[model samples]
Target: MIKTIIFDFGNVFINLDINGALQHVRDTFKIDTLSDEMTAFNSLYEQGLISTDEFLEFYTENFPKLSKEELVDVWSFMLKDFPEHRLRFLKQLKSTSKYKLILLSNTNELHITWIKKHIPFYSDFKNCFDAFYLSHEINLVKPNPNIYKFVLNQNTLTANECLFIDDNADNIDTAKSLGIKTWRIDIESEDVTNLFNVKTNLF
Candidate 1:
C-alpha cells in the first residue's frame, strides 16, 4: 500500500515557466547562452554545494553590469502565482489522514524568497505536507538516486510504499528506478487536482 505521497514543488505546487525565465534572462542580459562556468555554478547551487550569497556573487562578478536586484528579478521571473484552489485541495488531502504527504522541490533561495513574498497562501500550502524538502536546504537534488534514498531512509518508507509526483520526466524515471510509484504530471494544463482520482493506500 502507498503510505506516502511525494509532490514536486515547481510546476506542481507553484507554476514555473522555465522557457519564460530563460527567454527573460537572455533578453534582459543580452546573453545568447549560459557560460560553462555559470552552468557548473548553477549545478553546485542546485546541489546545495554553495551558499546563496556565493551563487549570487559568482553571477555579479561575471556580469558586473547588472545590479543584484536586477539579477534577483531574472532569477525569480519564472515563479508565478500559487492558486488558492490548489491549496484547498491539498488541505483536504491533509485531512484525509490516509497517507503522509511530502514535498520535494529543486529550487534556490532567490526563487523561494519570491514565493514567500508573492504566494499569499504559502504557509497554508506548506502546512499540508508532513515533510517539506528543498534541494538547496538539503544539498541534494531530484533525479539523483541519493536524494530518493535519503528520503526513504529518513522517513523509513519503502520505495514501493511511496508515490512520487513530478513534472520532470527524468526525475520521474529516477524515482521509478528506485521502485517508487510515480506520476509524471503536466504542470501547465493539468494540476495536482488530478490526485483526487488516484486511489491511494493501494499496493
Candidate 2:
C-alpha cells in the first residue's frame, strides 16, 4: 500500500516553459547552445553548492550586456501560473491524513523567490505537505539516489510505501529503481486533480 505521496513542484504544480526559457536565453546570448561550464554552474546552483550572489555574479560577468534585473527576468521566465484546482486537490488530500504528503523539487532560490511573490497561496500549498524538500535548501537534487535515500531515511519510509509523482522521466526512473512507485506525469495533457481517476489501480 502507498502510505506516502511525493510530488514534484514544476509542471506537476506550477506550469513551466522550460524549452521556451532555454530558447529565450539562446536568443539573448546569441548562442545556439549553452556552454558546458554554464550547464555545470546551473546544476551547482540548483544543488546549493554556490551562493545566489555568486551564481548571479558568474552570469553577470559572462553576459556583461544584460543588467541584473534583466538577468533575473530571464532566469525566471520559465515560471508561469499555478492553477487553483491543484491546490484544492492537495488540500483535500491533506485533510484525509491517510497518506504522508511529500514535496520534492529541484529548485533554486531565485525561482522560489519569484514563486512566493507571484503564487499567493504558496504558504498554504506548502503547509499541505507533511514534509517539503527543496533541492537548493537540502543541497540534494533529484534523479540522484541520495536525495531519495534522504527523503526515505528522514521520514522513516520504505520505498515501496511511497508514490513519487514527477514530470521528468529521469526522476521517475530513479525512484522506480529504488522500489518507489511513481507516476510520470504528462503535463501537456493531464491534470493532477484527476490523480485517483487516472491511477485507479494504485488507489
By lDDT, the best candidate is: 2
Over the stretch 95-166, how does candidate 2's per-residue lDDT look in tens digits?
A: 988999999999999999999999999999999999999999999998999999999999999999899999
Judge candidate 2 at residue 177 and give its lDDT. Answer: 99
Q: If candidate 2 were superposed on the true structure by all CA atoms, what would the RMSD be?
A: 0.6
Model 1 deviation from native, Cα RMSD in Å: 1.7
Candidate 2 regions off by >4 Å?
A: none
CA lDDT of every candidate: 0.86, 0.95
Candidate 1 yields a Cα-based lDDT of 0.86
| Per-model root-mean-square deviation over C-alphas | 1.7, 0.6
What TM-score number comes out for model 1? 0.94
Per-residue lDDT tens digits for candidate 1, residues 1-203, read 78899999887778878899999988987889888888899889887899888988998998899988888888888888777788888888889898999999898787788888988888888889888999989999989899999999989999998999899999999999999999888765677886756533334
